[model samples]
Target: MILIADSGSTKTDWCVVGNSGKVLSISTQGINPLVQSENEVERVLRAELMPAMTYISDITDIRFYGAGCRDEMITVLERLLRKVFPAAVNVCVYSDLLAVARALCGKNEGIACILGTGANSCLYDGEHITANTPALGYILGDEGSGAVLGKLFVNALFKGRLSDKVRTAFEAETQLTMPVIINKVYRQPMPNRFLASLSLFIGRHIDEPDLHRLVVDNFRSFLVRNIRPYCRPDLPVNAIGSMAYHYRECLEEAARAEGMRIGTVMKSPMEGLVRYHSDI
Candidate 1:
């Protein structure tokens, strides 16, 4: 049996596959070693994850792919998982970006991207990443991500780029004036999450020409700034995340404009991950 987990800032999806080919699914709050302490992560593993594994002892392998699982965080997560699943002999922790590459590209060489709360992209050579353009988070980069889209939309709303009617509707619906938005973004915690949450409003108005252009332009920036650095124009750009899935039309348009093509736009990596592991 093997256990696999794909984690992001918001949630984690756990899959348990038995030797008999049976699969069980479970959901738990996300675990980010970069943000949460070891005790906090261990608490979730024991309280939420452990209870879901009825055949825990049968598991001999564990793979954890998640956001913030890098450098020292990898060791931290490996220690916790080892403590939680002591029966497992093989344990590996990897970045969520690698997970996207593996899930979308499989064993084929291509460009893989993640457009979620934040943005990330890499050139994958089937089994490993050859190059990456740093995301630099929502503030410095993350062009096509939900957080950046919301940032652009909100900026347009307040800076007179959007129509008064649209602004009025947004303010009325979200009850977020410039003051509230300022507080939420500048003073409050998890500003990226707060900004990403506003993408729902952008999605609702995406059909409008201005809104559509905004989304397309955002994706264009992502391609120009992030993917272009790889200089692999011949490779089809594949992506995994809510931002890529929900706004696929806009993403497709941007790709066409950049003389690129879209491939394997998956909303989540769990299903593909399961398939990849099953095949292995």
Candidate 2:
């Protein structure tokens, strides 16, 4: 059997594919090397993940793709996974960026982008990433991402950019007042998640012209900054994430305006990843 995972900041998708084509799947809280500790990862995998699984012995390979998975971080996750899946003969850890490339492009070359709570893009040469634009997290970058969209909405409300009717409805929907919103964003933990939660308002109120324009502008920025650097007309440009998948129409429009061809805009990489590992 083979185990594969695609982990983001908030959640992870897990798939166990047996040799006979049987499959078992589960989801667990995210395991980012930059976010959770080694002990935390082991605890979650052992308690929340392993107990739900019926098979482990036949699992000969494990592939983990995640955020913040660099050199030392790779070692940390390998150690934890080894402890949890003791019988596994092989375990590999890589950056979530690589997962996106493999998921969206497969063995063919393309430009890959991730528009989730955070945003990132790279030029893939079929087998590996040749160039990339740093995702600078939520604060400095993360253009067209849920967290940034939330930040924009809050700032607009404070700056009186949203109409009175829209502001009131938005407040009603989010149940956030000026003071609580300020305190929560500035002092609270997981502020990125908190901000990202508000992006749903844009999806719900997509009819509003101002909101529509704002979303388009964000996508345009994403393209100008991330995609165009290494982008070409021949290399298919694709994206995968909740934000990209949900706002596909807006994204397509933006891509058209930028004179870039858009390819797949899947919400997650699990299906593509399952097929990828299946052939391996």
Candidate 3:
């Protein structure tokens, strides 16, 4: 059996493939190693993954592609998985970007971009990554992501640039006062994630022209700052993420304006990863 996982800031998707290349089960959980502590990661793995894999006792191999699995975090996750799947002979843990690359580009060469709570891009040539643009998190960078859009929205709202309807909708959804929002941003932690949460409101009003421009401008900035540098003017780019998939038209428009072509926009990589791994 082969176990593959794709994890992001919000959730983790798991796929178990049998010897015959048939997927036995799929599961999900919140296991972002960047945001959660070692104990927290172990808790979720025990509560979520172990239960899901109850029927399969003899696992032979496991591969985890996850967010926040960098540096020391990667070592910790590897140790934890090793303890959990003792019967498995091989286990590998890697960054979630691998899942994006494998799912989007597979054995072909292409540009693979991720636009989620954060943004990242890589140039892939079949088996390896040729180049990668730095992802500077939500505060400094993360151009075309939910956090970036949220930051833009908050700035506009506080600066009195947003319309009455937008203000009302935002207030209604979050039920947070301006002072509270400001305090959370200035005083609390994970402000980027908090801001990114506000994109849900923007997503709700995508049909509204003013709201649409906000999304487009942020996404455009993301492409220009992050993706454009790595990609040639004519390179076809494939995107993976909820924000990119949901606003593909705006993304395509932004790419065209920059003389680039948009290829595939996948909402979730789990299914595609499953297919890709099954083939392997």
Give the top-scoring candidate (lDDT): 1
TM-scores, all models, native as reference: 0.96, 0.93, 0.88
Higher lDDT: candidate 2 or 3?
Answer: 2
lDDT of 2 at 158: 85
The lDDT for every candidate, in the order shown, is 0.91, 0.86, 0.82
Prediction 2 TM-score vs. true:
0.93
Off by over 4 Å in 3: 19-22, 26-28, 32-43, 172-174
Evaluate residue 40 in candidate 1 and report its C-alpha lDDT on the 0 to 100 scale: 94
Better of 2 and 3 by TM-score: 2
RMSD of 2: 1.7
In the range 1-280, model 1's lDDT, one tens digit per residue, is: 8899999767999999765554899999999998899999999999998888798988899989998998778988998999988899999999998999999988889999999888999999988899999999899999999999889988888889998878887988888889999999999999999999998988898877888999999999999999999988889999988899999999999999999999989988887788777778
lDDT of model 2 at position 178? 88
Per-residue error at 6 for model 3, in Å?
1.6
lDDT of 3 by residue, 35-146 (tens): 7888888888888888767445667878898887776788888888888888888888877787788888778888899987778889888767788989888878889998
